[model samples]
Target: MHSQNNDKKIIKKFNESESLVINEFDKSGIISFAQKDVSNSFLRGTSNDFIEESTLYWTMKFNKYANDFFKKLTSDKYNFNQGMLKVFKNDMYEENNSKNYLLINSADDIKEMTNCHLIPILKNIIHAPKEDMGLLAESLVHMTLLKRKFSIDQEETVGGAIVVVIISKSDGFIWKEKKQYYSNESNKHLEYVNYYKSQ
Candidate 1:
């Protein structure tokens, strides 16, 4: 471990607060709209006191997914979509918990789909016309969402959140922390996709 410690001496000098943030991924997803329910106390503000459904974030996972989505988002030749993005007015979602599925299939729905890219996953929370909470961008989040879609046999969808990455002082990012962590370019791909971009 001595050699490992010696080689990573430069890491100590790297700025921890100097990390970069970008809004390109959300834009690239073409999620152009955001809706919120604020008449009641249902919509959890970013004060850390409320716990809404959270898609756990991490570094390696989010970056790779965001980077890939960014690439595809920029490529306009392909008509990418998040299938049917069920927009909810926070209060409407709360009142009709039993009928949540109703909000999903609107009369104006352009399509019916189970999967899309990462943009709607976020824009559903941080919509426009309000102060950007900047929460997701602030923290280094790595995640792997194990999807359990609802079937006729099962009436629930359980998405398991995993923070499978830890930002290393020595190595910038890794899938998981170990004795020796060196940044590998190829293995840097993050898996944040819930469903593949369906054709």
Candidate 2:
């Protein structure tokens, strides 16, 4: 029994260390995007200017599996099959129970939603390896989109938006902007992209 318990503890420790390493790598990708310049204008101006001037801010690497998972999460098929729409409606209702809930359409909207609402939602939804790092990256993507005045029809679609921003390994840093609409049938609304250059 003692030996079995020791073995279990050792395995658990190893798993925890592996999780930490993966989380670090995921965080490094976000840091890389944050450090790199989004445009020549960004280089000349202060950080605040870069935030204000750039339509699409920066791109970061995402784990391919996580990216794919996020895409599926936004798909109409997933929402329908999982009954996520009902869940989303409930979540929004709960959020607005005390006050009016408005569609996220601007930077101010995003700031208000994220600071008060979105963080907890992401934390609840994103449960996997490097969950905290993933939450931060997703939050940044949402903030960038809202800052650029991209319309996110519903809060539930935020995961899909994050997938749209995920940078592939082959593509180095690049800068581009375009409107993204959710391909999923459930939420056919204008999606925002800050810098989709990498994708």
lDDT of 1 by residue, 1-199 (tens): 0122321232222211112211345442211111111111111222111211121122224435645655565466666552321222334334433332322232112111111223254456445421122233112111111112423544333344433443434435644424334434543542222124232
Report the lDDT of model 2 for residue 126.
38
**CA lDDT of every candidate:** 0.28, 0.35
How much lDDT does candidate 1 score? 0.28
Best by lDDT: 2
Q: Across residues 1-199, which tens digit of lDDT does each residue of candidate 2 receive?
A: 0122433343344323322212222423223243222211122122323322231221111123434565577687754545675466456445533232221122233234323432343344335344354445555566544544554543332234345243334332222232332343543332222234436
Q: Please give the lDDT score at residue 64 for candidate 1.
A: 52
Off by over 4 Å in 2: 1-29, 32-129, 150-160, 164-199
Q: Estimate the TM-score for candidate 2.
A: 0.19
Clashing pairs in 2: 56-194, 56-195
What C-alpha lDDT does candidate 2 achieve relative to the native structure? Answer: 0.35
